[model samples]
Target: MEPIKKAYGYVTRTHKGRPQVLVFQHPILEAGIQIPKGTVEEGESPEAAVVREMIEETGLTEWGKPVFIADDRWKADDGSIHHRHFYRLDQKDVPDQWQHAPSGGGEEEGLQFTLFWISSPGDIPLARGHGDYLPDVLEERPEDGLGCLEPSEDVKQVYLIEEGVERIIGETREQISFEEGGTVLVREQTLTSEEIGDRRTVTRLMASTNRPLTVEDSGGGGMRAVYAGDHVIIERDGGEKRVPLHHLPVDTFSVELLLRTLPLEGTYALSFHAFNVLKGEEQLIEIHADEQPDGSFKAKVRFGAMIQWYWVNTETRELLKQSSDPAPGLKMEFRR
Candidate 1:
C-alpha cells in the first residue's frame, strides 16, 4: 500500500572521550525527546529531507553527509500510513555542546529548541514511531555505541555485574581491537568464585561490513558463527553447518547483534541458535523492536508462554539492562 513519506536523522559526535547523539525536546508538542526529523517536501528526495531537517531543527552548519540506513511503513494515529526513512550522520568539529532555537520550519519557526547531545546509543526519548528503525541502521557501527580504546592500549572498559540484591560481586574488563579490512574483535573475560557466585553473564560479539550493516560473527563459549557472503555458517558442538541467507532481514546471529540490524518497527523470528544462552534449549523466538522516547531501544522477545525484555543502547548496541517479569531472575543491569 502507498504510504506517506518522512525522513529522520541521527547526528552523532564524540566529545571528551564520551560519545553522544544530537536530540531535542519539543516545547509544545508531546514529541518528548527526539532526533531531528521532518516531512519530505514536494519534489524533494528523502536524503535531502534529512539534511534540511537537521539544519532547521538543530541549526548545525556542518553535519557532514547523511547516510541512508533503513526504512519502515506504519499507520499513524490519524490513520495515515507513513513510510519512514532513517539516516545517520557523524558530525565532526561540533562544539562541546550547545542549544538553539529553530530558524525556520513554519510551525517551529521561532520555537525554542534546546539542541543538545545525549550519551551515544544509550536510551533517550523519541516521540511517535520516529525511532523504530534505530537498531537496524546503527547496529553495525562499532564507533557509535561500542566503546573503543587506542590500538596500543589494552583495557577499553571495566564493568561491574550485580545481582538483584545489588551487591558488588563480579567485574569484567572489555578489550577491543580493530583489524584491517573493517573486521572487529571484541574479547571479554571475567572471574568470580566462592565469594563471587555464578551470577554474572559475559558475552562476545562482532559486526559486519562498513556498508549494509551485517553481523559478521557473534557468539559465546567455544562457538563461533560467521555470515559468509551468500550464507551463514555455524560452528558449534564440534561440528559446522551452513544456513541459507534467504530472508530480507536476517536474524542469524546473537539477539544483541540482530537488534541493531532491524528497523524500528521490524519483526523477525529468532531461531534456536540466535541466542547464546538458549542455543541448547532448541527454542525459537519472535523479536519486536521499538525505540523509546528516551533514545534507548526496547526489544520484546517472545517464545510460547515465555517473554523477555531487553533495553539496549542505540549507539553502542550494548544491552544496558534486561528483565523477565513474572518469571524467575531479577532485573539485571550492566554498570560501569
Candidate 2:
C-alpha cells in the first residue's frame, strides 16, 4: 500500500536560552493538543507542505528556514501506513500564549486554536503523537527540579489588611549562610508572629542542582517536613502524611527568591507544588507572568482560594509591590 504522506512542523524558539517547541489545542476540548501538521497535496513537496501547514495552522509569518529532520512510518487507527515527515522550523515572533483563528479551508476552518510554547514537549497533555521527533532537534528535556536557587540576604515586612486597614503581621527574612559552589544550597527562612510578639518559626528548604528552591526539609508551627525519595514526609500532630512531589514545591517563605531569579517574559505560566504549613498537604499552584511594555512585569499567582499579584522591575527583578487576601475579609500587602 502506498503510504499516505503527512508533514509536521516543530515551530521552535530559544526562550531564555532554552529550546522550546510550539503546540496548540483546539477550543473544542476533545480535539486534543497537537502540533501544526497537514496532509500533502498530490504534487506538493514535504518542505513546501510543511511551510504551508505552519502558516495556515499557526498564522505565523516570520520564521527561519525549516530544516527537514526525518521520515518515519506510523500506523493509524485504521491500520493504514502514515509516512510522516518532520521539520524543525524556528520562529521568534509570537507570544507565550494566544488564540488564533485560522482561515485555512477544511474541517478546521474558522476553528480557534490556543498556541503556546513548552520547554519540554513531553509535558504536553494528551499529545496526539505529534512530538515523537523532538529528540532529533532539541536538547534533552530538563529534569523536573528547581532550575537553580541562589537566595540573597534580604528581609521584608508583611502586613495584614482587613477591608482596607493594614497592620504589621510580622516580617519574613531569607539568607544564605554558606553554599559550597552550587553543589547543595541550604535555604533558611524566618517567620514571626507579631500578635504573640515572642514566638518565631524557622523553615529551611534545600535545592542545589539549580535553585535554592526547597525540595528537602522545612519545619515550624508544630509540623516537620523532610524529603523521602519522591515524596515529602510530614509529621504533624502526632500523625504522619506523605505528599508526592510533582513540580518541586515552593511556599510563601520561598517565593521571593524565585521572583527575583525566574526568567520572566511573554505572559508565560508555570506550575509548582505549593506547601503550606497550615494546609494538610501539597497542592498545585500556578504563576502567570506578563512582561510589560517597559520591560517590567506583573505576576499573578493562584493557590486554592487565594490569589496574589506582584509587580516587579525587570532589570533588577525586584518586587515593587504585592497584594493578596489571605482569608475572607482579610488582605495582605507589601510595597517598596
Candidate 3:
C-alpha cells in the first residue's frame, strides 16, 4: 500500500461581495465522485504546497493569507492512509490574471482543477470513508477569552452617530478614550425633520468637512447622521439628546489624552463587555492590535443597538481605535 499524499485548494473567485471557501476537486476511482482537497508535496511546506496547488487549478495569484482550519486523515484505495492539513484563504478579491502553465513540479501529470463558490460548509459533500472533520474546521472561534498574541498591542475604534453628528471613541489595551470634538471640523447645515403631528420641526447639525454627511431618522425615535470618510465616519443623533460630539459627559475625562496621541494601524479585535451600572449599563472594553497596515485598515463589526465610536486618521482612512458599550445582554469575550 502506497502512502497517499495531502493537498489543499480554496473555492474562490473575482466576484465582489461574496464569501470565499476552500475546496479541492479530484476524480474518485469508483465513479461519479470527485474529491476536493488540500494536497501535501514531499519536500514543500504544507502552506506552500496549498498555494501552489491553488494557483495551478484556479489560475489565481493573489491569495492574501492562509488561516489553518483543521487536519484530516483517510485511507486511500491502495490500502494506505494520508493526513491532509486544511486552511481557509482570506482574500478580498481574486486576481484578474492567472496562468494555466504548471511551474514543473512533483506529480504534475496526475492533477486537474476547477473553482467553486461554496455558499456554506455543508455544501461540500464529504467522502464516505473519511472521518468528519468539517465540523471542527467550520466551528466559530470563541469571540471572548482570546488573548492578544500577534502584534502584541491593539486599538479598537468606533463611530457613534445621531441626528447629523458623529463622535469618535477609542479603546486600546483596556483603556477607553474619546477623540476631541473641537479638532473634528464639521460643516454646519440645517434640515427639517420629518413632519410630526402637523408640526415640521427643523434641526441644525455639523457635517463632515471631507465627505457628504448622510442624514436619516433613527426609525421614528430619533435622527442618525452619518459621515462616510475613506474608512470611517462621524455620526450624531438628536433623539438621544446625548450630544455625543460636542459634549460626551461619560467620555469627557479622556478627550485630551486621546487627541494628543496618534494611533498606529494594525489588526485588532475589539471586545465590548456590558456591565450593569447604577443608572443603566456601561461597557468594559479591550483592544488587540496584532497586525498593522501601512495607512488604513478595515473591520466589520455587528452591534446590538448600542452606540459606538471610531478614531480614524484624517489623511489615511486608517481606523485607529473603536470603543462601545454593549446593549443589555450583548456582551462578547475572545480567546486565542
Which residue segments of model 3 deviate by more than 4 Å?
1-5, 11-18, 22-39, 95-113, 127-140, 144-336
User: Which is the winner by lDDT between candidate 2 and candidate 3?
Assistant: 2
Q: List the residue pairs that clash in candidate 2.
A: 147-210, 148-210, 148-211, 149-210, 149-211, 149-212
Ranked by TM-score, the better of candidates 1 and 3 is: 1
The lDDT values for all models are: 0.55, 0.66, 0.36
lDDT of 2 by residue, 62-168 (tens): 76667655454555788886787777898875689988887668898768998988887457663555766554446553342233433556577778888879888
Measured on C-alpha atoms, candidate 1 has an lDDT of 0.55
Residue 164 of model 3, lDDT score: 35
Best by lDDT: 2
| Error at 197, model 2, angstroms | 5.9
Candidate achieving higher TM-score, 1 or 2: 2
lDDT tens digits, residues 109-173, model 3? 45544334543446756444222333323434323111111112233333334443544432223
TM-score of each: 0.44, 0.47, 0.34
Ranking by TM-score: 2, 1, 3
Q: After superposition, how far is residue 66 of candidate 2 from its true place, in Å?
A: 42
